[model samples]
Target: MTKEIEIEAKNIVTKDEFVHLCSSFQLKKQDFHVQHNHYFDTAHFDLKEKQSALRIREKQHKFVLTLKQPHEVGKLETHQSIDKQTMDHTLATGIIPNGDVANQLRELGVTTNTFTLLGTLTTSRAEIDYKGGTLVFDESSYLSIVDYELEYEGEEEEKVETTFGALLKEFNIPKRDTDNKIARFFKAKAEQS
Candidate 1:
């Protein structure tokens, strides 16, 4: 089991802005990689109601199960690495293997018995070091949705926000309230239903 406070500031960026940032920041093609995120929730979206998200992310031949819950500065994330066999089983059966992540969800009133795969979002992402933090750019796709995002990850809460704000201002990117990828995916699913 792994625990951490994820402090990050992010904004929804336009395609042009994404291109501009990639060029201005000199982001290399080599740094870009693809990550597939499989999101899960109950029939009634119990976890989303609690402002939480559960996902199994596959990248670079590794799998990690993560549970993210709301926190003051950012989200608190609990991650557990699982083998491909367990991941395949969970994806096929909607039954999470018994473990800390399962127990954590149970404590939150979201049992694995009711969980199902809601959707999968794939992101072409790249990261660059900047201002004592990491800046991330993502082009994500799922269910007729294609969007770009800029995120700043930093150790300190206040500094992250400040630096991110400056970057936003410098680029003249308007501030728009952005939802987490899972939430956006869920909303799209709900709209189609």
Candidate 2:
């Protein structure tokens, strides 16, 4: 399993800032996720893209698993996750198994019409729990976005998450980087001007 250090910022930022910041920093885009993404006719999974990733989920001796995409990995660059978060760092955990996740998909307009399809599609995934930090870069989706989850571990299991627009500060290019969607978007935006 591969590993990554999730970066965190001090406060929330806007989409406009994300676009501007990326170009300002001269960050390049990379096709990092394509390697593991399993493309399906209608749905797929992507977490397996990193040759099995090692996640340092918040608190509780870090568990091991081949990073798995809990849902269909689409070309559109979209994803969803649940993190169990709390104020303390040592007790953090990420995965939360519950039925509410399906409802979340339906609320997001990602549901299907057939039961077979519904069973085939995945709406929720294992959670990521990190204390004093959260995941910033997602190698999925086509938007300039980042996510940070706070996890609290206990019998009750509480959680809180924060997602924001992202600004690619740098890209290693062909080696390790985003697919360059934000760059293309900004380029088109500049050309239209």
Candidate 1 residue spans exceeding 4 A from truth: none
RMSD of each: 1.2, 16.4
Tens-digit lDDT track of model 2 for 1-193? 2322223232223445434434453434631112211111112312223211112222232222222222332221122232333212212232222334334334444343111111111111122333433322222221233321111122111221222222122321111222222233333434656
Model 2 stretches with alpha carbons more than 4 Å out: 1-13, 29-193
| Tens-digit per-residue lDDT, 113-180, candidate 1 | 65789879999999988989999999999999899999999999999999999999999999889988
**Candidate 2 lDDT for residue 62:** 28
Each model's lDDT comes to 0.90, 0.26
TM-score of every model? Answer: 0.95, 0.20
Q: What is the lDDT of residue 36 in candidate 1?
A: 95
| Model 2 lDDT at residue 127 | 27
Candidate closest to the true structure, highest lDDT? 1
